[model samples]
Target: MRLETEMKMLQAKSQAGIVKEETVGNASRFIDVSAKHTKLPHFQDGKDDLDIWLTRFERFAESNSWSRDKWSSSLCALLTGRALGCFWRLSSEQAQDYDKVKLALMNRYDLTEDGYRRMFRS
Candidate 1:
């Protein structure tokens, strides 16, 4: 009976993890879809354009007095797909910046100047 209880507990934990992962995945997809529809100045590549978009977003967020959490979440939603594909192509420092931004968003309203490094990392 104890073994069975432990197995059930493990299964519950696994299911909970899967649900969290799905939530994150859905959020990532939302980001991708939003990015696809956003209009921007013409650029050579989508990945390059993503940088410009992020800069514009930061400026807008600042001007509007957006909270750090809002800015981070919005940026993550915008860059999620592009980040996955282009991050590896970026420099080591650039990748670190991306990770920082992502972590900040995950942590909520706690981003810093370092998080903005992603804007120039490309």
Candidate 2:
């Protein structure tokens, strides 16, 4: 009975995830990112606010049922100019290596100058 209960719970969780996916667009690339001025699905430039960009980017990634690799790859492809340049000469294709891309972006853009100081001091 305990085993059966656990199985049912797992099934329920999976079903819920499916339902959520449907709501977020189970099809290809949730929003027409190319059509938008931001060029990143629901994201906006917002004076290069990484917080706002990350939030929208995450939602976009999730909606398209992307993995970490896919998330990094897609974002890398869409980013251009200074935003794209920060990847240390790595292009969208090379930056598909999720961990490396994520680390570089977060270290440079996500963290404030003070945050970096605190990180090193700690």
Candidate 3:
């Protein structure tokens, strides 16, 4: 009965244009409704370099003309393993800020300013 009422409320919200409705292609699957859907390359730890991946993502975002406000959410979709975990560890507000999130990811992977300097020196 409670679930039914919640479903009805959700349906009403969808009808009223308060919530966007997403089409399901197959069996019902979870989707991150808050994110604006876009295809982005996933970040893999160990196998891939974070700095290179970040550069590629920035170029891709610029090429697509994606707004800075949408970058954090869109980028969240592609995070995995330690990177995803790094994102999760941030406070909700920090998670919404792309620069903060990026810094957190870089720090987690030992890509700090000193680390970059070491790389350059090497």
Candidate 4:
């Protein structure tokens, strides 16, 4: 009965996405029992529209129940070319902020309100 109780507790922890810490001798390691990692869409400069891509990314993140605070790092994984360059140019602190990163990308890609108006006029 005691072993069954422990197994039930372990199962509950797994479902809650808890990290298990195991220590052997003097060493300790963390085991991730979280859900499977979800892959975000990759952004390709010139090929993908920044505005549309960002919208899609947000939707995908929401659908996958990704933590809002982790979106910056998660989005960073799929950036490439000029988009990736813009991320790299940000200060370490700014890079960690999704809003700042999005702002920088929008500015770099000329997606501001005036820029959109100019595009529409052209």
Candidate 5:
């Protein structure tokens, strides 16, 4: 009777282990729908975080086979704060234009003077 109970307990533990292994991969998988919207690094204006955001965005674009224009617009979805409002005001027609969106973002979020200095020195 003891050996039978121990065998049943081992079987239950093995089943639980299999379940955990299967769930680990599903939990970690990320779907990049226009940069995964939620995962885009917040680009607060004048912060030293655009480089980080750009690298992540680039990876997202490549993984999802998105064009620069698509990236340009989806980027608007990731905006927060005053920046989010700025993108919202864009006319649907204007929003369809990638250059306009990109230019607007660059104008608002251009790096600080220190960033330029660092660029020139390197």
Candidate 6:
């Protein structure tokens, strides 16, 4: 299977909520295997850590034409509120904190600072 397809499948499994032990085991296996092969530096360098993932995601948003306010809000709602924080590894509190930080960064930079944008861009 393609890497993107594999990643999507794993992400879906992770979002499906905790099930039987066997199911959890399978999801864990998929994540472990994917992490081992992914080319993303954050994943390869043992920095696929939650914070790093958030940083990378923010950077991706900044590079686009979308306004920082919209991007940050949407990301906080999508990633932290629904996907990663809700379905993946981070706890609710952690997710909330991440959203706060992302929003703060957006506000601080007025959405124009190259350094701020670069921090999360890629």
Off-target runs (Cα >4 Å) in candidate 1 are 1-48, 84-99, 102-122
- Tens digit of lDDT per residue, candidate 1, span 1-122? 99789656655654543211224644521122223344433223334544445567767666654565544445544454435444334555544454455443323322346645664575
Spell out the clash pairs found in candidate 5: none
lDDT of 6 by residue, 66-104 (tens): 355454345544443323333334444543454555544
lDDT of 6 at 17: 30
Candidate 2: stretches off by over 4 Å: 1-46, 91-94, 110-113, 116-122
The lDDT values for all models are 0.46, 0.60, 0.81, 0.86, 0.61, 0.46
Best of the candidates, TM-score: 4
Instruction: Give the poorly placed runs of model 3, Cα more than 4 Å off.
Output: 1-38, 120-122
Identify the superior model by TM-score, candidate 2 or candidate 4. Answer: 4
Model 4, residue 97: what's the lDDT? Answer: 92
Residues 55-93 of candidate 5: C-alpha lDDT, one tens digit per residue:
677787677656665776778777777667767778887
Q: What is the lDDT of candidate 5?
A: 0.61
Candidate 1 lDDT at 48 equals 55
lDDT of 2 by residue, 21-72 (tens): 1234554222332343334643334455665677788777677566675677
Model 4, residue pairs in steric clash: none
Q: What would you estimate as the lDDT of candidate 1?
A: 0.46
TM-score of model number 3: 0.64
Error of 1 at 20 (Å): 34
Candidate 3's residue-wise lDDT over 18-112, tens digit each? 55556688533233333554666689878889989998898888876667877889888998999999999999999999999999999999899
How close is every model to the real structure, measured as TM-score? 0.31, 0.47, 0.64, 0.72, 0.46, 0.27
Of the candidates shown, which would achieve the greatest lDDT relative to the real structure?
4
- Check candidate 2 and list the clashing pairs: none
Error of model 5, residue 24, in angstroms: 24
